[model samples]
Target chain A: MIDYQLLDALAAIVSEKGFEKAAKKLFITQSAVSRRIHQLESMIGEPVLIRKQPPKPTAIGKRLLNHLQQVRQLEVALSIRSLADENLQDSPLTVKLAANADSLATWLPEALMLPKAEKVCDFRFEIIAEDQSIALKRMKAGEVMVCICSNEEPINGGLVSALGAFRYKVIASPNFVKRHNITSVEQLTELPCLVYDEHDKLQHQLLNELNKSVPKYTHICPSSEGFKQAMIAGLGYGLLPTLQLGDAIEQGELIDLVPGYFIDVPLYWHYWQTESPQLKSLRNFAIKVASNKLETLA
Target chain B: MIDYQLLDALAAIVSEKGFEKAAKKLFITQSAVSRRIHQLESMIGEPVLIRKQPPKPTAIGKRLLNHLQQVRQLEVALSIRSLADENLQDSPLTVKLAANADSLATWLPEALMLPKAEKVCDFRFEIIAEDQSIALKRMKAGEVMVCICSNEEPINGGLVSALGAFRYKVIASPNFVKRHNITSVEQLTELPCLVYDEHDKLQHQLLNELNKSVPKYTHICPSSEGFKQAMIAGLGYGLLPTLQLGDAIEQGELIDLVPGYFIDVPLYWHYWQTESPQLKSLRNFAIKVASNKLETLA
Candidate 1:
């Protein structure tokens, strides 16, 4: 049987991303952390960590991490059941959730705000900002307890539920529209387009449907607000969530390049089947908030 | 002599992160792109790109990329100089910049608004969000031409200048303050702290200065706005930019755990010494805009 203490050392090293930091976090000596990892390696008869600037786990190491995280979920549920005496007040559980930036820019904050209304304030969350395409991979790697992603597929031992959907419309500043005189599909290929990054293909997918050629010029802004600001500044034109446009379209600050056309992006909440009761209810609350704010796919 | 076409193929492959995408971007067949890379590899006597799912360039390949990007910078300068009679109106130059998320969350948007004020809008920008420590690494690898970082040391063939500064204050929501009764440094360690990510040492550094122990609980939010929202939601206390904390603290929604105490973060612009005239002027405009908005380091 593997010692759980050794596994905790490995988890801490990966979580903190360094031995020194892991030692600080675990309140142990740096060498002690190293010794625990070495003992684990000796027990398994294989090295678990790749010795790099910030170390990464080997394949078997990743499997170990996944198992430990699931076990942790069970422990968290037990703790929540024992919260009746208010024993777990000071010790807030650190939970990680992976969500795309676009959702975070609009309705996810409101979903997170549900905890405040319910008076469930015993959790500290790390909202990992990731592209929807990559968020599920992070969850599969056991890096997060819950994920808000576009992929509907559930990982092994995971449960997924529909979190409603959002629609994106092509938008540009009034000054940009007037400057470029964008009137047709061909003109859009000629004008500059903005994207979150190369992984972000909303612009590419939309443009391919309209024109044969990819965007002649592209701008990549990795931040949600920054991308919108870039759009509002007449830097380039690209897709924006209709929910986030708020008054930009009506106030004449932004023009929907394609008024009726939209690409609906449906979101799914992917959580561990063994997710703690607190996070499970939080996930349900998120779905409730999302359904209230976002349009239904049906 | 090595062919510039081969180098361009290598660049497009890396920029687009795949051969198929590079083929589309370069308006060449995939085989033609492959042949160019093979030719370049034969010339270098080493593999330029690793054949992974998303290809990565070798170290020597990075040196070659740095060289080509510099050449491209010169070409852009030439194009701008020859921009008489609006000849180059249709073709916009693509520029990549690396920035810390904190700036993007605050005054960077204002700084980016300069081009519109000056009627200079022929460039497309891709702002790569990264931690300040890691931003320089990407810039050094020639992933970006211009970088906004906290690093003071100038890289080879790079120019550095002050881009003003900002201050951070330790704050929490009024409810968090009341619930935790955080009146002393001891109480701080007892409460949870928030950091941008594992790469973010701002919270740890501040707490290390205040107390010998690291934060007992550290929540990591990777996005700028998400991090602030996590703080505002009373998930944890953290170091937030004073500029971003405006109204939240004054409006009685937040309380400064350390009143009048602050950590000033100075920013510097790191651009290539061979920066184009167009970009140089834009960089100067950013500096001017930043100076007007951000506080002086002194």
Candidate 2:
């Protein structure tokens, strides 16, 4: 077990970069900081900090540093929570969330605005990819209070509620269409198409819809932000989430081909079946936000 | 920032549920752990441990503990990496993989049995749906070396090779079939069906093939393993992944309904354009395994 003082010393030293600077930051003597680092190295049986003019952490030290930083952030969140508990009549409510990259990049950002909603509680967002079920397991372990996933089944007693369906469209840059003389998804084989990631389903889904195979030419554009950029760059014709494509389409950067043929993915928000006030507030707020953006299943 | 020592102390205390027990675990005096807790609270200006008889952590404390655990796991992984680097004459290789839950629960565990898979290098597996475009983004991020998705698009700088088309059958236990007396996918709405998750297109795909909407009474089965279990438990009818259903069907635990109709999600392994040794090894091995099990697309 590490001593609190020692971990504090490590954080201070890493942030300060040198014994002298760390000493000033921690209000300790430079020699004391050096001694503490020595003590930590002895205990861990590994050299954590590299001794240099501007000291840098070894891989071990870097890992330790990151760990400490996360701990500190948690502590900070806790303090705020405590203050809310004392000052407010109601306890601080946290809305734990899980979402995918595209959702995180697009509509999920609206979750940050939930705190400002009429709800009188704190909201904590844990944005994750839709692809990560392990995170869902964490939610099952009570790590998160709520999750927005394609997974409709409740994990470990979570209440499953339908949010809505998000529609996606096969899109390409106007320049791409003109350059390749393409009009249909079949022409995708002859042209490059932007994709969110290697595991992205747009191209595959496109082919499946056409009762054809996936095209031969594809470009990996992993980031949602970058996906738009890649489309504009004419890297390839890619599937664009309707929400993201709206602005680009307005700007004449991309064109929605065979517009009515869109993919609608049904989404659901699963929440821990708990009776906490904070969680209730979040659940209601999420429903309200999603109701506006997502198409309710008729 | 949280003092690392405080986190360590909290973990010890949480595990033991008492100061004395925690001290014993840490080989420190009870007073030492108590003092550290107190010091941590003061530093963070918040109370993390409830100081109850058993000394349970507050929600904030729990959050900090979770973050610390994640960091610690990363640290251990990094440590193992360093040790491997020092011992191996061959350069360390990292392989990134994207897969789905069905594969994860069934075929994937056996697929990763490469000799010295863990010892010589690091393998990061990113779990996603069998959708191809999702895998493409990971490939673009340089995060995954290969993906098992339903896309056969030749990535601009990558190669697209067929793994196989996995066939899924609409299945139900004999008990369930007898109870429901179901005949066609149209009667699916009348009988409860198990959906893998909200984003699972299986149910929707089934409904779309019939040009109908998803039924109202469909039960959400989020996990692949759990979904199988639920189907076996006669919770509902569902489309079962072929690999998982084979043995169970043979054993009469499950029975196929509407047998001739199946969803064939063709899988492909797309690798990066680079010739990195780590990637080459993974690509060849994956191809070898896939070829044995899957039909090639030529």
Q: What is the TM-score of each candidate against the true structure?
A: 0.85, 0.38
Number of the top candidate by TM-score? Answer: 1
* TM-score quality measure for candidate 1: 0.85
Candidate 1 stretches greater than 4 Å from native: A1-64, A78-86, A113-121, A182-186, A208-214, A246-252, A255-261, B1-3, B23-51, B79-86, B113-121, B181-186, B208-214, B245-259
Candidate 1 chain B: worst-modelled 10 consecutive residues by lDDT = B112-121
lDDT of 2 by residue, B130-203 (tens): 44436565554333456667767855556776677666788877777776776666777655666654456786
lDDT of 2 by residue, A1-298 (tens): 6675776787677656677888998888989988888888898899987665466677677666645543443554566556655654233333335665556545554533444446555332333454423346535533344567676677644578887777778777776688678756666655555555554666787776775676655544344544555566554666667876656788887788777888777777776544345555656776777788776765
- The per-residue C-alpha lDDT of model 1 at residue A104 equals 72
True contacts kept of 2: 0.00
Candidate 2 is graded, for docking, as: incorrect
